[model samples]
Target: METTILTKKDVEKILTMEDTIKAVEHAFEMHGKGLTQMPPKVYLNFDKGDLRAMPAYLEGKAGVKWVNSHPENPKIGLPTVMALLIYNDPETGFPLAVMDAMHITNMRTGAAGGIAAKYLARKNSKVFGFVGCGTQAYTQFMALSMIFKIEEVKAYDINEGNAKKFIEFCESKGVDAKIRGIEEVCDCDVLTTTTPSKKPVVKEEWVSNGMHINAIGADAPGKQELDEKILLRSKIIVDDLEQALHSGEINVAISKGILEESSIHATLGEIIVGKKPGRLSDDEITIFDSTGLAIQDISTASIVYKRAAESDMGIKIKFFDF
Candidate 1:
């Protein structure tokens, strides 16, 4: 059997924020209409990190992603998150492509953030704030820029160096960027949090009405970035209710008996499918709780595989003969 393998660089060359946003939006629509089959993410917790097994099947594609997030990886000169993906043939049950998934994960997650902002944020949003200026921050900003004519950006991170680097990246894209305190960043029209914090860093008082938030960082239980009060007052929209309640931004709040499952406004898919409305009023606070979905990975990987094949970028190897 022949299998194609694509590296991170190969994947990046074929993927862009513009195409990814549309793919993720379509994935959301398919998932919302019950046209896909995706199991809840299964986890394996360790002393310093955790691993996740995510699998899904769409109309003509199927795949599984094995990924891990190590918070202390930067100390060892490695990324905080890494992943590998296997794209298989649904009809024959054979592997078609095996590729690095780190880039795919970042891009899809960022696309999800962008899609959320499109449905939930006001059309005229300009000022943007980013908390936790890291790898995820770059993609999040890229996705937002695709949709809005952002004028200014305020960034904040515990590591001053990370904040500086994030600001520079933004400036490279012609965005007015600077480092600011958490309180100041929170005041922007659209705020995105991408840190792996264990406690709340954004205070309730800092959140103003008519603001939209992308709670992108907290994907595991006990990890939270926003104050419970913020969730209480905001119209929370999650990618998947089961996953978000167990691992996304609202997990911590729900565990403390503060926010209820019923309080969640709707899934992003629901809004995409027209089952629920999005951004009803300019003054209503809207929050997108993203936990990253298996359908997202599979959908994005399909696009990457197709593009790589068209460009003849990946290496094809014979792994088996029958």
Candidate 2:
């Protein structure tokens, strides 16, 4: 059997944030309507890193993403997150393509944030605040910019140099971008936290009314970004109930017995499917706790595979003797 192998650059050449947004939105709709099958993500923890296996089947596509997060890698000049995606033929149970998934993860996560903003953020939101100026932060900015006419960007990172680089990139994109203190960044119209912090770095008082927050960092158990008071006062939305309750931003709060499962207003999928409301009032603060979904990976992979095929990108290798 012949399988297509695509590199990161090959996949990046054909992927667009706008297309990814549509694909991820459809994935959410399918997930919300119960048309997709995605098992809960399974994890294997290490002393300093963790690996996750996320598998799903949706709209005739099947795939799995094996990804890892090593917080200390940056000190050694490596990325903190790396991923590999495998696509399969759902009908024949045959392997189709193997591709680099780091970019896909960034794009889909950013797409989820943008979709959440579309449904939850106030229409007039113009200022965007990004915490943690990494590759994921760039994608989040790109995706949000695709949806909103962002006028200014405020960035903060543990490494001031990294934050300054992100600001320069954003400024080159024609947005007024500046590196700011953490508390100052939290005061924007939309705040996205992507730092790998176990403790809450954003205080409750910094958040203002009508602010929409994309809590992107807490994808593992014990990781949290926002104070419990922020969740208590906001209309909390999650990507998946079981996953988010266990690993998303609310996980720490739930474990402390301060937040209840019933207090969660709705899942992002529920809002997309119109089962639950999004933002009720103009002054209501909304938070989208994003635990990345496998359906998102599968759906996004399907698009990349299609585009690659049409453009004749990547290498075809024979790996099986049948």
Candidate 3:
């Protein structure tokens, strides 16, 4: 049997944000209907960072992603997060392809945030806020722009250079953007937080009514970006209940007894599949706690694999004689 080797370039050529959002939405629908299998992420802790093993089966597609998160990597000329995925045939457990998952991760994570906003944010939301102006923030902007008619973007970062660079990127995209204080950023119609802060960086008082927040940074235990009080007042939805409770934005709050599992409104999937409601009123505050999902990677990978196979884009090598 031959296994296709797909490089980052190969995958990038085939994947698009539009297609990614569709694929991820389907994955969530399947998940809400109890049609997919995704095991809780297994983590290998390290002094500098951590690695995660994510495995999932959606419909007839299956895959495992080996990913790492090292916040200090950039100082050493590496990305804060990098990943690779092995796609397999569930029927025979055959390794069908191996591909880079960095873009897949970023796109799908952004797609999730967009999908969350679709159901949770007010339909007239036009002002977007970003608390972390890094690579992830770019994708988040891409996804949100596709969904809303964005009028302005408010960006904030501890590093002024990063925020300025992000503003330039936004301006090139023809969107009005400016660097703003964290409090000012939080005043937008929709707020996206991507900081890797261990403690709260966005306070409760800064967040206003009818705002939808995509809490993207806290994917590990003890890592939190928003104040616990914000969670207490918002209608909280998570990507995965178990994973969110363990390592998402609400983890610290839950551990500290400031929040309860029973307080969770619903999973994003539940809202997508109509099992629950999203943003009941214009005055309601909502938050989506995203920890990143394995099904998202697999689903996006499936699209990349299929498109690459049709175009004969990746290298194929026979690993075993059938």
Alpha-carbon TM-score of each model against the true structure: 0.97, 0.97, 0.97
Give candidate 3's error at residue 136 in angstroms: 0.8
Q: Which digits, one per residue and each the tens of the lDDT, describe model 3 over residues 1-322?
A: 8999999888888998999999999999998998999998888999999999999999999999999989799999998889999999999999999999998999999999999999899999999999999878988998999999999999999999999999999899999999999999998999999988999999989999999999999988999999999999999999999999999999999999999999999999899999998888999999999999999999999998998989998999898988
**Model 2, runs deviating above 4 Å:** 75-77
Across 1-322, the per-residue lDDT of candidate 1 in tens digits comes to 7899999999989998887887789899998898989988878999989898899998899999999978799899988788999999999988999999999999999999999999999999999999999889999999999999999999999999999999999999999999999899998999999998999999999999999999999988899999999999999999999999999999999998999999999999999999999999999999999999999989999899888888998999888886
Cα lDDT tens digits, model 2, 1-322, are: 8899999998889899998999999999998898999888888999999999999999899999999989899999989889999999999988899999988998999999999999999999999999999878999999999999999999999999999999999999999999999999998999999988999989999999999999999988999999999999999999999999989999999999999999999889899999999999989999999989999999999999999999999999988887
lDDT of 2 at 83: 95
Query: In model 2, what lDDT does residue 150 have?
Result: 100
Model 3 lDDT, full chain set: 0.94
Model 1, global lDDT: 0.93
